[model samples]
Target: MTPARFAGVLSAAVTLGVAAACSDGGSPVDPGGCAADLTTGIAAYDLDGLDVHAVLPTSTSSCIVANADSHFVAVDPSAQPSGRLFVFLPGSAARARNYRKIAFAAARAGYPAIVLTYVNDLPVGVRCAFGTGDCYEEVRREIITGVDASSRLTVGPDDAIEGRLVHLLTAMESLDPGSGWSTFHDGASPRWDRISVAGHSQGGGHSLFLSRETTVFRATAYSSAGDLEPLSATPVPWLDGSWATPAERIGGFISEDDEVVSPSGAIAAWTRIGLDDFGGPVSVDDTAAPWAGARMLTTRAPPRNAGAVFTPHHGVTVVDGLTPLELDGAPTFGPVWAALSFPGS
Candidate 1:
């Protein structure tokens, strides 16, 4: 997609007050790892054989406002002519940086990708401090009920989430110098072919939501159960009925022994996806190796819900139990990335 051709249609979209949706005047940080324009249409940047960049609604800013830095990452895979998109709400600067590496890998292997980084404000008092802690109901209630507080640190309304995402998309298509980083494929704004959404934990939930939106190609949900609290003996109502797409079309990656997210939940989610659910497990070995002093496991796909469960202690990879994939140097999950990298594979 050439910048000149994209500039034409993008010009009109920038007009109208829609371009001023950014809450803050701040610009998104490229971080040197990923490349792309943050405001208009998708800007394809070639890096290490990967086509990488950020895509968003034309008008944008850096803050977590209604339409601040909601961006997407686009990567072209070497193995294939097309690419994949990873969509999520940006949690922090660190995670965004790491995501660039993952995108590079996908692109190097002949797969282009996209990551959605939109702003979302968690309710105040909603402590996500402990890994063993569960706050499913509290969080769910918070979502449906807007937070009311004197200090002004409360949750927003129903459209609060999707509304903001749409604003970001609008800003991307708009033609505004201030809101300047939205991008799309084929140089046309908002091209939604072969894209996928992904996130970790809460972000994963957002990915699933976007999948149903039908604005992208497909969705990839990782390590996120809509209900975070540990389920009681009685079956709790899940959003199984409201899946954005058919269960089989959604890709889920979870650890079998994940304490944060129960394996039972993963299985249930898979069942919801039905027989057509894509990808398989890549088990990581938990047994200790003689020389390495740690057990090694392998994953056929990417592994989520492993950080807190397996590496709870931090800086060390454990191998006591095994999942489909193991995390060692340069983590690789053929199964998880399989669907995202190669949708029909």
Candidate 2:
């Protein structure tokens, strides 16, 4: 876009407030080796035929209050569009760049993908540990919609997760109009029905809640669904709250030996959400693609970093650092990701 035209869009964004702070023109990056993509517990994904970019959101815009980092965008140069956008969110305090492998896999599966940067400094469970079940749901509502429904965090409409997504998608439309990002946008809001949502850990919880709030194309959680209620065998009972996505339209993946959230609690949450209607949680290690048509999927696969002292069970499913590697350097859990979010590919 011309500089003057870009300025006009920025002006419009500022006027809109909540939708402000979309990205500047995205900058191409070497996917195989971005320094920040790899850290103490994060991994960098190598590119196959995908173009990876780091697009900085405008700090002047309202949508970037709690955090002002770049969002990661991935696209396969040679794949046919799948008529779907794969949206990935990172865990608490995790950087967006750390999720390139998951996003790259999505791109290869024919869906353009993005790893968003948002206000994830405060984990939901940590902030709402002592409250009732509604506290968990309402905190998430505040985070995603800026509804001020909870007191855990002060997220405004502009700094809410939805606002950040709207901003980034708007950025893609303005800076890369020919890239087809507009297909996921309807008017000023995201066409959530055409978007598939998934994430790791805390992001996974957010994914579940967002799916609950809207009829997303699909909802998949990796290594998380919801936090367990303290001193209880279940997650905070909020699935029965106002809902949109059905249990059948949702899928989840996790390491069977996760150390963060109790496996039984996760299973309890899934069962209560009605995932048992599709089928019980199936192990990906013994089963293949369809996984017996199950919506709740689990794996006993050991982490690659198991020998490095102790494995971080929570990172085994999708994080680059702990997830095992295949012979070709692709993520060991690559196929599982596609399975969890299939039909979008």
Candidate 3:
């Protein structure tokens, strides 16, 4: 389904729910019900083979985190576990429930996936818009660890992105002792080496930022490059910093016609991180699966244009309603998701 149209499905899921078929009229099968946690507006999907659960951050900790209504955990028992978890972050102000399709796709591919709810109400660029040196890194540090590094915002440690992941896994381990979720975290810290990170828009930038903090299994970005300073249009200083994850292990997808963020600018940021050294991004539209074995990827798919109410092309690569869909209601970019977020190349 297109990302622009997913919202309509969500609103209807609140009311019609199981009674509703795919609102975009692409799927022939009737869904039994909405994906887990309808009150939080997870889209109606074929959840038959997946064990999906909505976890509130507060369900595991006393701190009330952002997007508390729809933190999701998905696993498909039918698939062989890859022994790694896929962690996803939503764009600024976007809800976690809206991203279950991708998470479910990761789960079906045999990775435990969580669409985390972290503090992302403000864009990282906005927070660092006019700051003194590399405020981009400082804001990301504050958000991830809840340290008072940037003067713009204060994220508490318990409410920090790292802390919330630890809490979620700790709670999940307690809920299902045999699931082996405990391997990703101990009581205190996340075993960053055991996790793969992916995100859309602001979440995409944060994913790369997280990769810098620790050695994640892999890093994938969708519809995102790092934040650009508005005036000069130059990338923030942190994009050129020392990264723990190598460029070869990093992969990403972006829209050629992204309206919200410049596609060339996005590629420039990726180049700054050395993604262009192995190979420049190949077009997912013209190229077949594996996309010539390139780590960086792009698509020529156009965004949904609804007269006066338009969805940005920036979201065409993932969600926000512009992502293309197959006739069976699966995202056309499913292969891209697997190639990027899967356990290894």
TM-score of each: 0.53, 0.83, 0.83
Report, for every candidate in turn, its global Cα lDDT versus the true structure.
0.40, 0.72, 0.73
Q: Tens digits of per-residue lDDT for model 2 on 1-345?
A: 346644554554343333312332122111111111111121113366666656654432433557767778888868888889999988988888878888888888888898888778878888887778788888888877766788777876556677667756765554445568867876446788988888888898888988877899888888886767778757776765656987777888888898887777788777777888988788878877777779888888888767653437888888877888889898977877886774644
Model 3, which residues run further than 4 Å from truth? 1-46, 65-67, 304-309, 343-345
Descending-lDDT candidate ranking: 3, 2, 1
Best by lDDT: 3
Candidate 3 local Cα displacement, residue 13, angstroms: 27
lDDT (10s digit) by residue, model 3, range 1-345: 345444654554344222322112121111221122233423223366776767666555544435466578888878888888899999888888768778988888878889999998888877876686478888888888767787888777666787778766765654434558989875557877878889998999888887776788888888888677776657778888788988877887898877667778788888888888867589988888877667788888865542323446777777736677888978889999888888443
Better of 1 and 3 by lDDT: 3
Candidate 3, residue 176: the lDDT equals: 39
